[model samples]
Structures are given as structure tokens and as C-alpha cells.
Target: MRAPYASDPATARGRRVPEDESSFRSCFQRDRDRIIHASAFRRLKHKTQVFVEHEGDYYRTRLTHSIEVAQVARTISGALHLNAELTEAVALAHDLGHPPFGHTGEDALEKMMAPYGGFDHNAQAIKIVTSLERHYAGFDGLNLTWETLEGIAKHNGPVTGDLPHALADYNALHDLELDTHASAEAQVAALSDDIAYNNHDLHDGLRAGLFSEDEIAALPMVGPAYAEVDRVHPGLDSYRRRHEALRRVFGVMVSDVIETSRALLDDAGATSVADIRHVGRPVIRFSDPVWAELREIRQFLFTRMYRAPSVMKIRAEVTEVVEELFVLFLGRPDLLPKHWARAVSAAGGDKLLLARMVSDYIAGMTDRFALQEHARLIGDG
Candidate 1:
């Protein structure tokens, strides 16, 4: 049974553009299906997670990371007796706005767009769903339910202060209660993202030779996991040993969130979704001990993996790719695909509008497609 605070599809606030309800699926399920089929979601197959798309077939791309996140979200939501469908929908759609080379691409775009209201992946995600997607016959975008949209926009926490332009524009049309916390399902998705990345980055870092098993084996949560695995399965091969220890580490994080959040929810006395929103703080989170340990793990990864010499070299190269592409597209709007012509014409020589149009085009590109365009347009091949 779902918790009283869980979002109910029957009570969903409905989509911006009303449509007949699905006979077999709940509204949140439909939202999940739509997100899965989106063109933006498909492009994640070639978008970077930690490594560039062509770096190796083994590294996780945005697509795989999203899938893993959804899995973790489902597990946590189910354990918490929350609405798993809504949680899964938010998890699956969370990274839809990430550009070609991951953070490197986003950083370059943010610099280029500083004058044009800045660039935020969270806000861009709202933009992509609300306006950029033009597949449906009746609407410009997927027309997801208000609940799903809220989960997507505020999954991290309440939005206050200066809102991202993309989110602001959409909020004006339909109020998303920007100053309030999102539902517990959304909170579950956010924490699931944390668990998924922390676990997988270790796996990927090991695979990339940025660090070794012994190096990580000395870390807080990681050390105990390795010791436990060795006790249970002595003389295990290196590959199996690494996998066993990491899976235990993953389990520990999941269990910690489930236990911690459950206590917080019970203590908050929240009996409805509204109570969850107005509860003044996030109920889903790792235990304080786990949070501190995770920090140590993150710091280790930040220094040893994310900022290693080889990775820094690649970051610089990809940053150049995103920067040059923005410049090229802004100056030569005519080089944009024919489908973008209408939007370009609509810009009517307004620099901000034209630059935003260019930003959308480049932000949607896959890593391979961005590289291909760079070579074709700038003769950089």
C-alpha cells in the first residue's frame, strides 16, 4: 500500500493540454512512457556521463546512468511505500537536458549564455518538455501532468531566488509552486541519483585506470565492504571481488536512505502529499554518518578521478568543442538545420532570442553529433 503522503495519479493535477486518460496506464505511467520515447532521451545514448561517448564502449553514458537511476529510485520508493511510478518517471527524465560532454558541455554553454539568462540543465529540462518537443499532433511538447512536471522541476528542493529563464517562462504559464518542496517521490528520485552516481563512478574510475581497487579499498564505507567480501568469499578473483564489494557498497547506501528517510517521514507527521511539500525540509536523505562518509568518498573521487591529468586534458578538448559550436551557430544561423529555420525567422534579429535558439540546437546534440558538426562546419577534423 502507498503511504498517505504519496502522490496519487487519480488525484494528479492533470496535464496542461488535456487528453483522454489511458485505459491501462495511470497518468504517471504515461508520463514515464512518454519520457522514455522522447528524442531527447534517445540522444542520451551518445551523451557523456563521466567519459566522452567515443572514449570507450564500457563507460556509462547518460542513457545508462538514467536507467540505473530509475532502477534505484524504484527500489527506494517501493521500500518507502511511496508512488514508485512517479519516482521512476522523475529519475528517468532527470538528465534529459544534459549536453554532449556532460558537465564540460554545460559549463561552456553557461559561459556563452551568461548574458542570455544563463544556462541550467534543470531549467533546460523544463524547456525541452514544455516547448522544444514538437512531436505530438495536438501539442508542442509531451504535456506531462502537473505532478510529473513538479517532480522534474523541483526534485532537488524548493526553487527560490532567481529562477532559470526556461523554468520561469513555463512557471508563468502554469504555477508549479516553485517556493515549496516537491513530493516525496521527487525526493526519492533525487537521492537515487546520488546513490547511482557515487556507486557507478567508482566502478567507472576503476575501469578507466584513474584509480585502483586498493586505493578505494582504503576509503570509509568502501574499506568495510571489501573486508566483508573477503571474509565471505576468500580467494575470489579480482574482477568478481571488485564487483562483490561495490555491490555491497551500493546496498549499504540504499539501505541507509531507506532507513533514514522512513524515520524522517514518520517524525514529520505528514499525512498527505501537501504535508510532504510543506514539511519544511527534505525527508529523503542518507543518515548523517553515511552522508559524512559519502563526502569522504566524493572528495577522493573528485581528486583522483574527475580531476586526474588525463581527464582534465579531455575536459579541455570537449569544452572547446561546446564553446566553438556555440560561436559558430550564433554567427552562422543559416548553417542550422532547415527545421530550425522557423524559430530562427521568428527571432527577428533579437540577439537574445537568436542566441537562445542556437543554445537549444547545440544543447540537444549527442557527443558524436557535436564532434561531427565541429569537423564538418569548422574543418577541425
Candidate 2:
């Protein structure tokens, strides 16, 4: 049974291009299926999360990270009596807009496109679903339901101020109520992303030898988790011990969100999805104490893992790849793929339009593909 404030597919704001109802699936379920089958979604396998895609097989790529986020989203949504399908859809589609080399690539692209509209993964995601994907016979994009689009547009919270050009363009056609908070499902998806990354980055960092198990054990939530694991299972194998402790840490974060959000939801007294959106604050979040601890953990990761010397070196290398590629393509639109060439030709010497076309083409390249293209075209293999 769904809560009063949970999104119901039967009452969903319908798709932009209306279609016959599915015989078996709800509107949200259809939305989830479309997202899972999207070409952009499949490309996530070779997109970076933190480490570049070619770094290691075991490290989480964007694909695996999205899957983990979806799992956590479903768990939390179910616990809170929200729509799991919508939450899972939002989670699965959240990072579909990320460029080739994770943040490194995005940073480079944003710098290059500054004179244009600037690049934003979140807004690119909206562009991808609403206009970029061209598989449907009846529509240019997926024609996802309004609720799904709204969730994708503002899942992290309300989007205000100057919107990304992609989002701004779409919102002008169909308003996503960018100034209001998203449904409870989207809020759950956003937090699930937080949970998945916090836990997995530790595992990945340890695996990469950037940090040791003993080092993270000194952190706030992690220390208690390690102590409990040691008390219950002394002399455990190193691998098993690491896994057990991290899982416990994951549990603490998940449980905190659930318990704290429940309290917030009850206090808000939002008996409808509209009320939840207009509640003037996020109803889903960690408690103040837990958030403080998480912040400390994030700071440790920033120093010991994200901005570590080894990682920074790789970031520089990949940032150069993205920058060089952006410059090369911006100068020579004739080199773009045939389909993309047609789009560039349609730009008719408009630099901003040409740059956005280049951005879309380059942004879609996998990390390996970007490297190969750089080697092939730039003679830098």
C-alpha cells in the first residue's frame, strides 16, 4: 500500500506524446523499462564513476554505480511505502548524463562550453530523454511521463536560478515546476545515490591501495562498524573482515535515512504528492548528527582518495584528453560522424549551436572511445 503522498501511476501526469496504455505495466513501470533500455543507459558501462573506465574491471563504473543506487532506492522506497518503480527509474537514470571521464571530463567540457550554454550532466540527462534519444517512431525522445521527467529534472531538489540551456529549453515547452521539490520517490533516489557512493568509494579506495582498512577504521561511523565486526567475529579473514565492516557502515547510513525521513514525513503531514512538493523543505535526509559524521567521512575521502596524488595525476591526463577533443571537434565539425555532421551542418556557422552539437557527440563517447579517438586523430596514442 502506498502512502498518501506517494506517486501513483494511475494519476501520473501523462507523457507529452500520448500513447496507448500498456496491457500489463503501469505508466511508471513503462518509464522504468524505457530508461533501462535506453542507448544512453547502455553506454554507462564504459563511462567513469571515479576511476576511468579502463582503470580496472572491479572498480565501479557508472553502470554499476547506477545499479547499486537503484537497489538502495528500491529498499528505501519500499520501507517508506513510496513507489518503488518510480524511485528505481529515477535512480537508474540519474547519472545517464555523465560524460566520458566522470567529473574530469565534465570539468573540461564545462570550461570549453562556457561561451556556449555550459555543460551540466543533470541537464544533459533531461536533454537525453526529452530530445536526444531518437528510437521512438512517434516522438523524437522517449516521451517519458511528466512525473518521470520532473523527477529527473530536480531529483537533487528544486532547480532555481539560471537553468542549464538543455533544461531551460525543455522546461519552456513543458514546465517541470523547477522551483518546487520533487516527489518523495525522487528524494529517495537522490539519497540512495549518496548511500551507494559513500560505501562503494571506500571499498574502491581500499582496493586501489590509496587507503588501508586500518586508516578508515578511525573515521566516525566506520569506527563503530569495525568495532562491532571485530567483537562478533574476531580473527576473520582480511577480505571478509573488510566486506563485513563496510556493509555495516552501509547499514548505518541507510537506517539513519529511513528513520530520520520517517520522522520528517510525519511532521510535514503531507497527505498528497502536491503537499510533499510544496512542503518548503526536503522531507528526506539524514539526521543532523549523522550528516555531520558523513561530512567528516566525505572530507577524509576527498583528501585520502579523491584528491590524492595518484588520482590527481590521472585526472590531469584525462582532463587533457577531453579538452583536446573539444578543441579539435569545435574547429573541425567535418570530422564528426555522418549523422552528427548533418546536425553540425544544420548549425549553418552558428558557433553556439555547433558547440552544443559537438558537446553532445563528444559527451556520448566512452572513456576508451575517447582515448582511441584522441590517438587516431590527434596522433597521441
Candidate 3:
């Protein structure tokens, strides 16, 4: 029942380690299940999206953000007659490699690991699935369908130039067509990420008291949505007013993506999944007007919330933790966990390889774990 251009699991480029097809599940379904059960997926529950994990119970974690993205992706994919399951799979796995404390943690890791094939979460996600997840007896990683790996590797777009070393190494072993775009489902997942984060961050930022309703009232689409909600529900409680307005904003984004993508799909005349890859531009996107409005909303959030003094204070503290931990592990590789220690030892005193292993260990840590590790190792606990 898939649309002509939908990624059909029946003809999926099979896993690296070949195996018999599942009797009950499509390849994408199996991919989703495997991702759900991964150790990295479980770690997401305590990983920060914007707010630190210990900041509040209400803020979204990487786990919840991934779920929200999956929901948005499924909705858009279903509307477009695309493979919703594959879209969901990609969405769920999209943030698997984000370090603790949101982008702050990633920034620290990237800086610390700059000498050793710099850290990119997208590339780290591919590394996690293709080599880090050692579960199955026959394979070290999930051995996901080729499409799933491609989506994880290139969901944003093509990797046409110098690549993250992790991605480049894996691409050498099993080509992910680094020069081309991922499937349409991946494009949906990527856009869904945008819709979910922008909307939810606005909600979280408001709830955190980083900005007031009046402050955001001058922003683009968000301002109009808030005004409309207030007009419809005069004197509504602050909570409900905020909820109504944000939900409208979310709906606007979804509607824009669906409407714009539908037109693009029709125009492209792409009758198969391969046709999507060669379209040379993403078919999933918001209209120009909506995209500009979203940019304004993002600017508002950036000034009022993301870079707010309160948040940046914590960002500085967490960045210090990541940097110290990287130095600690690099200086004393034996301090890493047993398996990580073995890998460091296997590196045979190659400082660069050992640094990369330390990067992997730290990048895998949850916010709480990273903080605790920093304390325990650096004598602040």
C-alpha cells in the first residue's frame, strides 16, 4: 500500500550481515524495534535537549524530543502516503548520539576531540548503530537495512565534501551514497525534528520563565498564534493560553510542511524511492514564507531563551565537565570502563585513536552520569 516513491521495505537494501527476513515484521519495523531497545536509546531518557536533566521534570529530554519528532514524522509521512514506519524509525534514532547538556556538551566534545576526527552527532549516530551497538551474536551493531543507515547518516542532506572520520570510515566499508540525499522518509524525519524542537523549545522556554508571553508577542508566527488564542479565549489561565497558542504554532508548521511537500512531490514526478534520491533538492520543506517566519521565531528563542544568562551559566559548567573528563580519560586511559579501557589498550599508545575512544565513552554518557563522572574523577563529588 505504499506510495510509488515511498521506501518499500520489501526491496530494502539488506543488512551488512545478511540474515533471513523476519516472519512477522518488515525490515523497517525491525529497525524501529532494534533502535527502541538499544542501550543508547535508553540513555536518552536522562539526556538534555535544551534544559539540563536536573533542572526540572517538565522540560523535554532527548527521549521525549525523539518521541515527539517521531510523532510529527509519522503524521507527515502518513499524510504524504510515505513509509511512516521508516520515518518513525529514523526520527527515533536521529538524536541517539547527542551528548549530555544539549549542544553545550556536544560543543565541548567536538573541541576536545578536534585532534581526533572531530565529533559530529550525525556521524556519531551512524557509528553507534553500525559499530557501537554490540548486541546480536552475529553482528557487532544492529545491521540495519541500508536505507535506515543512510537516513541516519544523511538525513540533513548529502555529505559531499570532507566527511566526519567516523562516517568516512564506515562509508568506505559499506557505501551509504554519501554524495546523494537520503530517502524521502528521512527528509520527513529531518523536517519533523525542526518542527518538534522549535515548538517544544518555545514551550519549555516560556515554562522556564526565561521569557514572558509579552516578550514573545512581537515574534513572527508565534506572535500571531498567541494573539489569535488570546482573542478566542479571553482571560484564559496563563497555562492554557500558552498551551493553546503553542499548539496552533505547531499545527501551522505541520500544515506548511505537508502542503509544500505535496506540491513538490507532484512537481517532481518521482515514481520510486530512487527517484527521490536524485531529485537534487529536498522535497520536504516548509514554504518560503513559513520558513522565514520560523527563522524569526528561532531568533526570538535564541535571544530570550537559549542564550539566556541562566542557561549559559549551566552550559559553562557542563562544558568544563566534558573538557575535564576528556583530559582525565586521555591522561589515564585505564580509568575508562573495562571495555573502553581494553579499546584504549588496543590502540597501543596511539594518542589519536585513544582520544577517539575517550570521546566515544564520554559522548555516550547521560547528563546525570557525565556530571557524576566529572565529580568522581575530578574530586568535586
Q: Alpha-carbon error at 219 in model 2, in Å?
A: 0.2
- Per-residue C-alpha lDDT of model 3 across residues 1-111, encoded as one tens digit per residue: 678999998889999999999899999999999999999999999998888899999999999999999999999999999999899999999999898888999999999
Question: Where does candidate 2 stray beyond 4 Å?
Answer: none
Tens-place lDDT per residue, model 2, 92-152, is 9999888998988999999998989989999999999998999989998889999999999
TM-score per candidate, chains pooled: 0.99, 0.99, 0.98
- Scored by lDDT, the top model is 1
In terms of lDDT, the poorest run of 10 residues in model 3 is: 336-345
Steric collisions counted per model = 0, 0, 0
Whole-model lDDT values for every prediction: 0.94, 0.93, 0.92
Question: How high is the lDDT of residue 287 in model 3?
Answer: 100
Better-scoring candidate (TM-score), 2 or 3: 2
